[model samples]
Target: MNTPEPLASTVVIKTVNLGRTLMDTEQQPLTILQGINLQINAGDSVAILGSSGAGKSTLLGLLAGLDQASTGEIYLNQQPLTQLNEEQRAQVRQKVGFVFQSFQLLGHLTALDNVMLPLELAGAKDYRKKAQNWLERVGLGHRIKHYPNQLSGGEQQRVAIARAFAGEPVVLFADEPTGNLDQKTGQTIIDLLFKLNRDQGTTLVLVTHDLELAQRCQQRYLLQDQQLILQTPAAVNPVNAEATP
Candidate 1:
């Protein structure tokens, strides 16, 4: 038997004692997440798993700096998110990309233009070429001129993926990238995600309820009872039976 090679030591994202709390309808305190400590290394694929309303998305939002933690600290590429202002955090988010279950493509924009939007905002010299290249890479070359509504669900998701990688982000956060598609189509999207992750060496942090999808990641954490629990391979199979969102 051969031992697998260890992941690189570079930490792209780290959190310490992270927590989030919200007020209930009556204004009483309700805790969504608490005491989360995690370290995601460079070029690693990580998955956050839990039942619906288990604070999985909350954790992802905090990790990506899209939302603030009510307590504790988060370090993104060594920049402290807990200390950054909104504008400063937005600046830090430039190195990140996102894919949503809804696909989140602008309906009015052509696939090509949708992919070009971020690059153009960043003032890339050749946004069109870069967008076209990514579209081609995602096997959407022929449909670049199509609008989101004109494409199939899977096709729209491909464009979304192309848009995400077009910026060459250091980390990609996908919240149920395959949630909208049928099982077969979802599998195709999953394969594309991992291929892009490996080819681009981008760190992947995925939030999903699908056990099979979570299993594909290098590291898996279950968000339950307001805590993050690392799952061993042996433990994953049992979770799969009941894992649902």
Candidate 2:
């Protein structure tokens, strides 16, 4: 599959000396991330790899404006997130989408409803049509009426992906998106993710422990010991090249 070239040099996400800390059981401050500085260009795919408990998800949450940092600042679409209060941060997140490992779907809502909920909340027009279109794009159209419990893990994830892209977000943050699936299922999900990234030009910031999945991205970083380390040069998609005939 062909990857889309970045639309411009626009920086969709940037971090400056970003750090996060939490109080431990005994009241000692435990630093999870520190001194992290990075810039993600529009239409780029970035992977953050780390062992479990290395704060990869924490960093993702901060970058997505779902959580505030203990120090430093995060800018999403040129808006400073660290300086914004919760409500203000939510306004900034209107342009953002998220996919999680646990599928994060409401048990009672059908797949279509799950995808439509956010759009409805945001007051988007023709939200039902948009939701249906996205579900079809993710190959879940036939399962639109199925609840999360009725679908397999991969199917549930496909619904989640549909929900994420339906909003037409500028950036998509995925946390261990394929963590619950078997290897084969995970590969299918990864392929779907890249295909959407290529087609829609959504900047992808993924957090995962899977190095193979990380290699599929344009840039890869390893989060370790409270720091982010660059693991590869940007704009290199070895997996895509190898997939070419």
Candidate 3:
């Protein structure tokens, strides 16, 4: 008989009835997300598709421990986020990586230094070599010395990706990673992202308006009306169902 893996080992992130809300000056409650539940297995690629202001990024932020939810539970690698303090959550976040729509690269740092930042922060030795290797893998070896403004949008995104991967996080969350690029460039970035995700076996949870990109993931989620729903019929083209907002 084969031994089975622990639940924690198989599931990278899980949530139950997760929700977030805010209050206006009048203390009027504004609900953003409610009854949001999700599960992402190790090495799985999942995408959450929604129009603008549908709370996709908000949900991602909550799951990533970047923002606290108003209610419900979130488990990251079997650790309960609701129970962890802000400082503790920050520690947890160190084990995860993120790629944002803006690329989020520091303008003053060269591509190499940008990639090296996380590794250095983690006190990892030989960060320079590791960062260089990741940059080369992303086809930016020759451009490692280039600053963010000196590089094209695609090149800058590649540098951001390299930085995200350098830390070897257990999971990666990406929000509108290709939103700023042209279609052709977006496709290239998508290919690179999925390839790296596959090669590294990193769990991927992405939020995007791009139907084609979302379809590439193993599972699909649609955020609507402050709720998260699984894509039905399994073969429906998301783009045909809703316009990218």
Candidate 4:
């Protein structure tokens, strides 16, 4: 008999009965997440859809090793987040990238420098060239020398996206990525995100209130009544469904 090829390793982020509770001044616990279970495979693009106060961002923070859940477990790339100390979790963060809605660029840093910050901190050489290349990829080549204050909101957001991709993180997460821009600019950023997805094979997880944007992903999740729920029978366009098969 012929020898079988080795099975590919599985890369996934998973959570079981994950929960969070906030304590008020009176010491009463207000539960935000209850029994949340989520699983995301490598190279999967997913949108976390929910209204405000639905614990969407909170869940992201926990999964990203930013915060501890009150109950349950989270495994990121087969490592137990709960078992890792703060420093250890920081190490894990090296393999993950994030984009924020607020365009969290430093006012003093130029677009190019902002994108180079992470790489330089990690002691990578030739950071300038790599940063410039990523900025160019986002169509911000001419604006690379511009400071955050000198750039428009959309331009700043593009810089942020460039920075996120510069790190080459295995998993990418975004919170309200397009919430701060005009419809046209936002649409452009969305297109760039998809391009990165197609070219880099990066796993994307985003939290958004926009239905149309969420529908673009392969999977969509909602936080309902303190639970993480995945809705099946995708609302994707019929054209897309037929093309998949």
Q: Which candidate number maximizes lDDT?
A: 1
Location of the lowest summed lDDT over 10 successive residues in candidate 4: 236-245
- Per-residue lDDT tens digits for candidate 3, residues 1-245, read 34323456699898989999989789999999999888899999999887789888889999999999899889887678888899999889988999999999999999999999889989989999999999999999999999999999999999999999899988999999999999999999999999999999999999988878888888988788998888854644754546644
What TM-score against the true fold does each predicted structure earn? 0.94, 0.91, 0.94, 0.90
Residue 38 error, candidate 4, Å: 1.0
Model 2 lDDT on a 0 to 1 scale = 0.89
**Candidate 2 worst ten-residue window by lDDT:** 236-245
Task: For model 2, name the residue pairs that clash.
Answer: none
Candidate 3 vs. true structure, TM-score: 0.94
- Tens digit per residue, CA lDDT, model 2, 122-204: 99999999999999999988999999999999999999999999889999999999999999999999999999999999999
- Candidate 1 residue 91 Cα shift, in angstroms, is 0.7
> Which parts of model 1 have CA positions greater than 4 angstroms off?
1-9, 243-245
Candidate 3 ranges with C-alpha deviation above 4 Å: 1-6, 233-235, 238-241
Please tell me which predicted candidate would have the highest TM-score against the true structure. Answer: 1
**How many residue pairs collide in each prediction?**
0, 0, 0, 0
CA lDDT scores, all candidates in order: 0.91, 0.89, 0.89, 0.84
Worst 10 residues of 3 by lDDT: 1-10
lDDT accuracy of residue 106 in candidate 1 = 93
lDDT of 4 by residue, 174-205 (tens): 99899988889888888888789888988899
